[model samples]
Every structure is written in structure tokens, then in C-alpha cells.
Target: MHVRFTLQIFAVALLVSTTAARAGILRVYPGESIQAAIDAANPGDTILVEPGEYYEDAGSIYGLRITTDNLRLIGKSKNSHSHPSDKAGQMSNRVRLIANGAQETGVYVAPAGCEYKNSACAEELQGFYLRGFSVEGYPANGIQTRWVNGFQFVRNVSVNNLNNGIYPTLSANGLVRDNISYGSLDTAMWVAGSENIRVIGNELFGSVIGFEITVSNQVQASHNKIYDNTVGIGLFHPNGAGNPPLPVMENWVIEHNHIYDNNRPNDAPDGSFQADLPPGTGVLLMGVSNHVVGKNRVANNGFVGIGILGWCSATTGTDNSCETRPPISDPAANDNQISLNTLNGNGESPPGGILDFLAADLVYFQLEVTVGAGNCFKNNKPEGLTFVSSAPNGELPSDNC
Candidate 1:
């Protein structure tokens, strides 16, 4: 009996080890191709492609496509490292989801419906982690995640001639950290309608717009070094009505960043046709509110460091329940706290101070000030800035240095 018990215990241990080993690691070799591995992946499985050139055919499928939920597409351990440039060999075999008569994003993760209706009834893809990967030369955005939730990107890098380096839309609670994103004709990081996002500790350069956050809420972009781009950070508001109401951009924390040498070569217009004037700033909040801009060092840009344009939209309400309301008929960018920042030694002086109240100083009459009020500006080391506009009309609050 004692001998039988010992044999049973050994059998259990073997079963556990086998289950862990079979969890998921589908390898895609040079000749074997990605489709073979993708076909073998179950839900929660990982597609691991080896380091080799993967020249795809036009009108072909994607490099890594995850229609099921909870899938991970990662590179091999050797390929995911921070090595010297392997421009020709390494990137040549990358997953290119070109628009070569095909209709798909490079790394496409769409909603799992109409296709997988039985075994897994289309769980909203969450925990989709793409790590240690290089995405380049795609037809659309290099890495686009549409209709996903709780996604995380770690140590991923993209370079050389793509649309948007990383485009994420209609997601929630996403995190993008420790990545190098660059060389796009359009916006580098375009995030929309994604809430609870943390964009921290990344390096971005060489794009028309370094980061573009529109109609997003509860976003905190900090500790990232952004430079050598056309526009550092472009925030926009949709004009007029009849479109879907703009979402409120609230509780945003833009801090502890080194942004410089932007607006290089010349002041060129971005995707929105607005030029990113140099000595680029660390943060630019436009028509946004309930934001805290502090601990950032903005300098050496052709334009002003932080420019705030006061505009109103009915949708700017309800990002958070604790926000105070404005008290005017016209729209105003109100209740934003700007403090503990540094701005000095930029190119265009006086007009390009570390912080410039553009809506008040330049385009006050055009802004529609409504029930919003009290935008704060204090404790800032401004090399060339002073209060030019009258204090907020008792409806708005301010503390200037």
C-alpha cells in the first residue's frame, strides 16, 4: 500500500507539469509561417514568432490576428531584446498587415462576434498583452487595438514609416509603458474613448503628433520623454453639434516629462493643420478641464509651452461626478490646476512662455464661457510670462504666480 501511494503522488506531479507546459507557446518559424501557429492557438494561448524576416503577400491575412479573447502575441526571447539595429534582417520578417488589397490592421484584435458564437461566445478581449515585439511598415496604424479592454503593452518598439505607431480606440483601463514609438507621418499614440489609461515612462520621437488624446477621460500621461516631433501633445475638441457629443477629458495628470526640440526643421501643421511651434512643451491641454499640469519642464519650443483654449461642449460633463460646474452662458476651459512647473530658454520669447493663457490673452472673445469656472495657475517658474487678462469673471477661480 505504501508503494502504491508513492506512485500516485509521482503521477500527480507529472500531470501538473504537463498542464503548465501545454498552457500556450505556438512557435512560428521562418518557413512554417504565422498562420500555422495561429491556427493552433486556443483561447488564452500565446503566438510566439521567431526572429526572422516574414515577407507577406499582398491581400494576405495579418501577421498576428486574435479573434478569440485573452490571447497574447509575443516575440521569441532572443528577438525581444534591446539590441543594436538589425534593420535589414530582423525587421524584414516582421508581421506586415499591409493594405495590399487586404482589409485589416497589422495586429488586429476585433470584437469576437458573428464568427465564434458557440464554444466561446465572444468574450470582450481583455488582458491582451503584446510584449517585446517590433511592429513596422504597416498599411494602417502599426499596432491597432480596436474594441479591446484591459490591454497592456510592455517593452514594445515601433519605427520607420507607419501611419499611427499605436492606435487604440474604444477600450478601457489600458496601460502603455516602457516602449519606443516613432517615425510616423501621423500621430504616434492616438487614444480615443479609452478610460483609466496610464502612459508612463516611454520614449517618443519623429512624428507629426507625438501623442494625440481626443475624447478620452481619466488619462494620466507622466514620466515620458518626448522630443524631436512636430507637435508634442495635441488635444482637440469637436466643433459644432449633431455629431456624437464630445467626452469629458478630466482628472488628467501630465507631469515629470522632458519635452524639447519639437517643432523641428520648421513649424509644420499636424494632422489637424495646427503647427507644433517649437521649443516643444511637456504638456498641452486644449479645451480640457479638471486636469493637473505640474512638475513638468517645458523649454526651447517655437510656440508657447502650455496653451489653454477655452471651449465648451455639452459632452464635457460626467467624466467624473465630483467636478464643479461653470456659471456662464459661453463655454470656458475652467477648474484646471497648473502648478509647480518650469519653463525657460525657449526660442520665441514673450509669446512662448512656459505657460500662456491663450484663450484669455489671444482668443477670449471667441470662447463660449458657461457654467464652468476657476482655472488655477500658481507656483510656476516662468522665464517670460505675466498675467495679461483680467481675473476670471468671478465665475472662474485662479491663483497666479
Candidate 2:
């Protein structure tokens, strides 16, 4: 029976590869719409679009209304396709795709519109590969996915956009690698409520929300070169009615990243929009738990480096008090481990430090210290670390730093 199960798994993997390879070779023309080809594509098929301009109306090309899984969208040009020589010591060709229409998102992954009900979306899609494509000029997001699994985005690029370069919502087990994401007023990438996801070996520059991960669980973000972003890496929660409160977001690992020179001035007319500042910081963890942020080189942030701010909000509570103090604090945001990070010339602009831990409202504890509050930290090396507590004692000594 064990052997049988193993064989079954192998067979499934083989089927996946077979379908993927078949899908990889199908060529799409200039006159034919990319969406139509994707709609006709079967699972495990590759759709190759030649080098040319393709016009699309709002919404996604593949699996726009219906949820289609296991599809690979690639390019046919040397610039769009993988470079011929692996070790050529040369810049590989880049695929340039121009979007000429208004849409909610450039390339999105979700169930069909028919699946939209009440306030929830269909969650039956998984395993989409979007490569060698350039997406631009979207009304909302560049790429949006929700409730899917096993997505691979490689060697694709986006520019001159309005929203996020890539937005994946409520997904599990995906990868964003070797891509260039830029020229957006909004986030470069925004991921929420995801698990087992990775953002590695990508270049993100010039965006409102660069590398924003909020309300997520069990994610790993590392080894990517992030620069010139307003909020290099952001983690937060959205306010609304009947919103699912954040549960314990656990087992998140952030390591080996080069985050530098992120402090860009906020372009939003309203000062309340804080997502667009290019402050130099590696990781910002709020409303999250069981996270590990280490081995990163962070520098030149306008504000504090590696900030940990715990705030609360209530759905059903006294008027506007929930904005300041929710009836319940997110239990998950507590308890984290941060260590082994290199900080250089950080906090040049304002209240800055290599590390800053700001917590409030739980009146029992004193200030200036972080320990024994159901959270733990050890072996942290920040050039200038500061621990700020609003509680009574309100401050951990420099030793804790």
C-alpha cells in the first residue's frame, strides 16, 4: 500500500509536468486575444504568446471568470523567453508587455465571477505560472490572486501602473522570483492571509507598497533585492465591518535580504497615506506572531528600523474607540524572535534605531523592556536598538538592546 501511494503521487507529478510542457509550447498570435487562448487551455498546458502588443479589457486573461489551474503563460522571444546561454556573463533578454486597456487588475487568479457570493469569493484554483510578460496600466492591481495554491511567477516585469505589481490574497504555497516590478503608485506586491509563500531574487523599486505582507501565516520572505520603495516591507490589517479578526499568524521566517535606501517621500495628497515612504527598514511585523527576522542588512530608513507596534481594534465596540483601542488585542501579534541583523546608519531622519519595539494598552507591564509577555527574543545584534514601552516601567535598558 505504501508503494502504491508513492506511485500515485509520482503519477500525479508526471501528469502535472506533462500538462505544463504541453501548455508551455502553445503559441498565441497578435490578433488572437490572450484571454481566449487561456480560457480554451486545459490544465497543465503552457500558452506561449509571441513578442507583440496585446490589448485586453479589464479583468484577467487566464481563468478570468472561471478558475483555471496548472497553466503556464510564457513568451516566445529571446527577450521574453529565457536567455539561450545560462552562464554567458551577460544580461538576459527582458520581455516587455504593454497593457493598452483599463482593467481592475493586469493578471489575476481567482474563481469565475459566478463564484462571487455574499462577501466571499470562490477558492478552488491553484498552480498558475505567469512568466516573460510585462503588465502595465491597470486601474487596480497588476496581478491579484485569492484562495489559490502553488503559483510560480518568474522572469516577468511590470511598469507604469496604478496599483500593486503583484497582489496575492488568501493563497498558499507560491513563489515570486527573478522578476522586476516597478512604476506603480501602489504596492509592488501585497500578500494577505497566505501560507508557505516566498519572495526571492526579485528587484522591486518605486511603489507605494513594496513588499507588503499583512495578516499572513507561515510565510518566508528573503534573498530579494528591495530598494527605492516607500514601505520596503509592510505588514498590517485592514479596517472594516465583519472583518475576520487576525488569528495567530505563526511560523513566519524573514532572512538574508538586502533592504536599503527605501525612504521615498510620500506622494499621496493626504498625509494619512503612509504606505509610500521609502524608509529604510527590513521587516515590519504588526499583528503577527511566531516570526523570525534575521540575517538582513537594513539601512537609511527615515523612521525606526524593524518596528514592532502592537495595536488593537474591535468590530462590535464603543463608537470610535476601536480605532484607538479595540475590545480585544490580536493574540497572534504577540510573541516574536528577532536577531542577527546588520544595521548601518539607520534612522538618519527621525526617531530611528536598528530595532524598535513599541507596545501599548496592556497596563500591567512597565516600559522599556520586552520579555515574559508571552513573547521571547535573544542574540539580536542591531547597531542602535531601542525598546520603547508605554507601560509603567516603559523602557528596557540598553542591555536589552
Q: Please list the Cα RMSD from the true structure of every candidate, rounded to 1 decimal place.
A: 7.7, 6.6
Error of 2 at 385 (Å): 5.7
What TM-score should be assigned to candidate 1?
Answer: 0.73
Q: Against the true structure, what is each candidate's TM-score?
A: 0.73, 0.76
Give the per-residue lDDT digits (tens) of candidate 2, residues 316-344.
12232345444243422455566677766
- Tens-place lDDT digits, model 1, residues 1-401: 99999999999999988866767867777656565566577767888767655545446445456666667777664533433125553455343222334533456665645221122234466668787667666655667666677788876766653567777666678898887788777667777656888888888888877877766788888888778776677664433111133445577777887776566442333422333333344345555667777788766655545555454432233321123443222345666777777766443533343334331211111145343456777666753442233344622235332
Relative to the true structure, candidate 2 reaches a TM of 0.76
The alpha-carbon lDDT assigned to residue 249 of candidate 2 equals 56
